[model samples]
Target chain A: MPTVKFTQALKRFFPGLQNMQAGGKTLAAILDEMEGHFPGIRRYLLDEQGRLRKHVNIFIDGALIKDKTHLTDPFNDNSEIYILQALSGG
Target chain B: MKTTLLLGTRKGFIAYEYRHGAWQSANLSFEGQPVSIAYADPRNGTWWAALDHGHWGVKLHRSRDRGRNWQEVAAPAYPEGAEVKDGQPASTRYIWSMAHGGIQYPSRLWAGTDPGGLFVSEDEGNSFELVTSLWDHPSRKEFWMGGGRDLPGIHSIVVDPRNENHVHIGISCAGVFETTDAGKTWNVRNHGLRANFLPDPSTDVGHDPHILVAAPGNPDHLWQQNHCGIFRSVNGARQWEDVGQPGGPAWFGFAIAVADDNPLQAWVAPANSDETRTAINGALCICRTDDGGRSWQEQRHGLPQSNCFDIVYRHALTSSGHGVAFGTTTGNLFFSPDKGEHWQVVNNYLPMIHSVQFAD
Candidate 1:
């Protein structure tokens, strides 16, 4: 099982978002699991093409994900996943 | 003057209500999001907000109870395998404009987006499908290039009041397009327009009309604040004639407002020029034409006299009844109760306003 966490900013739209443990081997699988828990949360993270949004970032075990387009960045069952927004510009 | 004014801004969506003889902040929604468009459908009084999220993609929300409650709906999307150019995939980038279908079709909506796609919703915006006739037009791939942004965007959608089937749209670097058969077919409506930025200034498809507006009293009469100058067409945009002051501040501007009651009357906010998009001579002013553009009156009273740097976007200027209002890129809003004769500051501080509409 992998533990997943979210940025506090996402709580504005998804009120029930919380840190939880999930069973998944890949980043996309974990996102699918998150979507099962949060119906509309997938669109907020990925675009219609299933690519990571330009201003959103994902981390696996404190390292940035390798692939943004395919979300193929590998993760282990016990790895920690973090989703955060890139707030660089005003 | 209308009772309510809706504003879509860089920071949020705000509404001001005129009550007890003064305009006051009535409500604020999407307080931290970039509301690209705040539209109030005249047919049903439903307010729609087009949010442009920096982290997330564009989203649409509607409020039937006037901001008291909201319902999030799916924004328009490009079908699978849709491509903007040969190798680039197409997706809804930014929603630049939105318009209601009309009274005839109560459950209709139109949306214009960046990367040059027009979306129509026949079910009151529950879902939207791309108008592929215009998207797959022959000239779109070759002549449609970006104006200021990286990709070409459609910023204006004019739904004719008399007949809902007839509509007009303005595209940056792509010229005006008209549809008479309800999006089944589209024709280029860029005759008598100039595109100085192009190598050939008289090209048929590359002209950029910054803002296109149709008079409410007479749909045949149209006005556009072009990148080169001000233009007007009395024959329903079949041909455009340059009507801007040759040596005046009205020569270059982005926003134009036509009075709803009088087809011959209109207002435009004057900017410095294309090179420097600021207030003319550091003084904020609006120009009004009452004699069908034969002459223009510069309305400068009750505005900043000097030391100003404000540029009005196309969607930030509006006119209805005897009222006219404009919002600036520098967060300044001005309103006139008597057809631009005199102005008053509605709010000195606000976010960069993207759209302004006078709604009841």
Candidate 2:
């Protein structure tokens, strides 16, 4: 199981799921698991065309994942995944 | 001559007494939480502070007695779940930027915000009405949000001092926009800017122009600190060239100041963050350029270099007759008498000092 953590701002939208444990081997699988727990969370993550929303960022570790659309980054056992609302401030 | 310092803090705003040879903080509560931008209207003797806090939301606070007391002009309320006709919300995320129109129209105030929106207050900052004409423009539909959390939030709103009709705005990751027709249309004006990390032309070019400053005397002269490097525009961003690296530690700070007495004079303080690296042991020094950003010199006569734990936020740098002043995240304030050299910590132990402006 990998752990997904949400930032303080996103907590308003997804309540009680501050940090969730997801069963997945890859980034897409983890999101699929997230959708199962909190529906429409994935919609805010993606846009009308199904592309990742411009403001959502998914990081496997500290490095930014390049595959924003499909997120093919691999996940290890006990891997730490973070879903941030992307700080859009200057 | 006398100097008045307006300090915009996260909690609220404070006025400083610079008459007896030192700066003293005069606390007031025009803001509910943290404040980001404070503009002093010298024409009508009004001080304006822009607020950005959670739950309390965004609004404006005005001071007529030079910060002795304050009043809030309630921000327009958007319906609970009303989406903007263009598919966004009316208020967006928060009020991120505010600017006085120009010396000619001192009563005019312009504001920009997150997600992506623009508004103007015609009646002396009493209230603001969204400029739906610009938001509802056909091109706005294609206006892509900068594609990440560090994406498009309106951060820079610059009004041409020479021409009131010409306006320039910088969005978080969306680069720079200009309107020649007052508010009729806007064009993405990014020519010599670059985003070295992102290999795409669209994304890399406009990823966060943190500060875009136009020369107070010459509207055509401008300077900026974006995601990549420090840039200068001689013809109002029509042409630009790299000026300097945000020198000193690996830091990215927002807040740029230019001297009103000298058009070619400018200063920038580098911080530790997303942009680039400063020296490992570098103190937060104000980098100055007297030749219109063509060359640079570092000024650190009096500043913290050992336990240098301060980050200057946007809209913090301000200059006037007394000198150039800026506040830090560590609650320490610094002022320079001869531009950037020979600084002093005039005030210490205040709340997070977000902005500092010298006026009246």
Candidate 3:
């Protein structure tokens, strides 16, 4: 199981959302597991094409994810995944 | 009766209520997101807010009990494996504008989005389906991005008051389009509009209409604030006639608003047309036309008279039964309780105002 953490900015919409342990071997699998707990959450994280949005950044174990389109970042049992929105606006 | 001003800003949404000769404010809903459009439907007491999360795509939220509580709805998303057509993107960027779907269909709502698409929701704003006829049109290839982001956007939606199926949409860099048979088909309605940025300035498809508004009293009359000039279509958009160049200021602006009762009266915030798009002469004033944009008058009673560089966006200006209200890029909101004659600043400081609408 890998632990996934959401930023405070995302918690504003999902108040009950919190850091949780999920069973997944890849970043996309982890997001899918998270979406099971919080329906419609995946839409905010990924686009319609299942590609990572331009303003979203994901890091696994202090390392940035390499694949944005496929989201194939590998995760282990104790991996820590952090999801944050890039600060960009007018 | 009370008037509520819903201010959508670059940061969040603000709700201001004016009653009893005073004003009350509440920083309600979408605390840290860019709200592109906030519409309050008095017909069904439903409030809709379109939040553009830079990283998270777009989200649509609806509140039945005003802004006290909200529930997220299904925002417009292309079908899985949807093919990109005519250089249009495959995903929806943002919901730029939303309008109620006429009196005939109280439960219907129309939404315009970036990447130049139209969506409709028959059960209020809960769920939306893209209008594919307009999206797959061959003329969409002529559309291009203007001053906005990467793709062109449908920033204005006008539904005919008499018929719910008769709809009109205004796009940036694509001009105006109308459909008589609902979303089954669409046709270019940009006749007599100019596209000065292109090699052929008279092209029908590449013109940029900043804003398109229809007078509630007379649905046949349409007013447009274009990139080249301001125009009025008295014959239901069959043809447009330039009405702002001879007497109006600069003739380049983003916002255009028309009164609910008077089809011939309208207002626009004039800005310099060159590189720097700011208030003319550093003076902030709203130009008005009483004879359907033929002649103009400047109204700046309480507005900044000099050194003002604020620019109003297309969706930022709105007119309701109460009066007209508009916000600036400088984060200032102004209101005119007595039509467009006198003005008063509602709030001088907020996040950069993106859209302003009156919730009657």
Per-model TM-score on C-alpha atoms:
0.98, 0.72, 0.95
Residue B341 miss distance in model 1 (angstroms): 1.1
Interface RMSD of 1: 1.0
Q: Pull out the clashing pairs in model 1.
A: none
lDDT of 3 by residue, B152-220 (tens): 788888888788789888888788899998889888898999888889888868888889999989989
Per-residue accuracy of model 2 over B1-360 as CA lDDT, tens digit each: 238887778777777877567776665765436777676776677877777644325556788877677776754333333344345434445566777777777668888766566778778877776666655555444543553233356778888866887899877666777897666778777788876656675442345677788877777878787666777788888866777654532124576777776668888777665533332255777777888776777776888776566767667776775388888877878887766668988877777887777777
What fraction of the reference interface contacts is present in each model, in order? 0.56, 0.00, 0.81
Please give, as one word, the docking class of candidate 3: medium
Give me the candidate number with maximum TM-score. 1
Candidate 1 lDDT over residue span A6-75, tens digit each: 9999898899999989886778888999999988899899887788999999999999998998899887
Deviation (Å) of B167 in candidate 2: 1.2
| TM-score: model 3 vs. ground truth | 0.95
> Which regions of candidate 2 fall more than 4 Å away from where they truly are?
A1-90, B30-32, B76-92, B103-107, B137-151, B201-205, B246-252, B273-282
Poorest lDDT segment (10 consecutive residues) of candidate 2 chain A? A43-52
DockQ: the better of candidates 1 and 3: 3
